[model samples]
Target: MSDVSRLADRLQRVLARAQEERTERDELVDGPDGTECAWAAHERDQMWKAVNALRADDGRPSIPLDDIVQVERQAAGHSDYSRKFALYCAELAQK
Candidate 1:
């Protein structure tokens, strides 16, 4: 019901949609030839970064896009990571 909860729900839907697309494509191969997968991954990463930024300390401010992109690459194959990240964002949003 809260803003963070709403954001988390939206993110979960995004992740689910990405997963569905990947499944339909018979797995997403991230490379020059895999533009669709790459774009989906990028979108997921941006959403995660946006949520993360909302929880950053005042002094630290922004997280580098490169860092977020790297994390997205590492987490792309794991649906658990997406769910956990959404939960984390919700927790932060609560505070």
Candidate 2:
């Protein structure tokens, strides 16, 4: 498949893991309780790292987490999120 599409698929998986981990982190009662919490933080970091790696691969500046969070929160589940993500991927592609 095309490079952008392939990258998008990878990004989707990473984003899903990141979101799941973030939920766990947010729901924790004591806030970052060691290994489990560390894992959650690592997952979140992986998402941004993947994003940055993709951008750096194309010689583009890394996108900010705030910008990505904006995209993640743009719409309710199963609404226009996919379209937004695809558009975001396309923009990231810059190809």
Candidate 3:
């Protein structure tokens, strides 16, 4: 695949994996809807941060989550999406 396509594919994989982890967390923690909602919001915040970094004009090589990787992973492990929606979001995020 071309470079951009490869990058996008990798991102999709990351998102899909994040979704799976999130589902597991919800099951393990037994959090209420409000807590789950907050977790989802935080996950989106991390995603936007990553996207902005990816869109930056600097020439330096970067990985979007390299700085806040811990937050990204932890928050994602508790995201509240159902499997279908998570897959849908992953598909959209790639575009």
- List CA RMSD, all candidates: 6.2, 6.2, 9.2
Better by lDDT, candidate 3 or 1: 1
> Residue 77 in candidate 2 has what lDDT?
75
Instruction: Give lDDT tens digits, candidate 3, residues 1-95.
Output: 65455545555555555555554344322232234444444454445454445545344344343333333343344554333233333333344
Q: Sort by TM-score, best first: what order?
A: 2, 1, 3
lDDT of 1 by residue, 1-95 (tens): 87767867866676665566654454454643354555465555656555555656333445444544554555556768777555454554344
lDDT per residue (tens digit) for residues 1-95 in model 2: 87766777777676666666664464333213233444444543565577778788879898776555444445327575644564465455453
Q: What is the TM-score of each candidate against the true structure?
A: 0.41, 0.54, 0.36
Ranking by lDDT: 2, 1, 3
lDDT of prediction 3: 0.43
Residue 92 displacement in candidate 2 (angstroms): 2.9
Give the Cα-based TM-score of candidate 3 against the true structure: 0.36
* Per-candidate local distance difference test: 0.56, 0.57, 0.43
Which candidate achieves the best lDDT against the true structure? 2
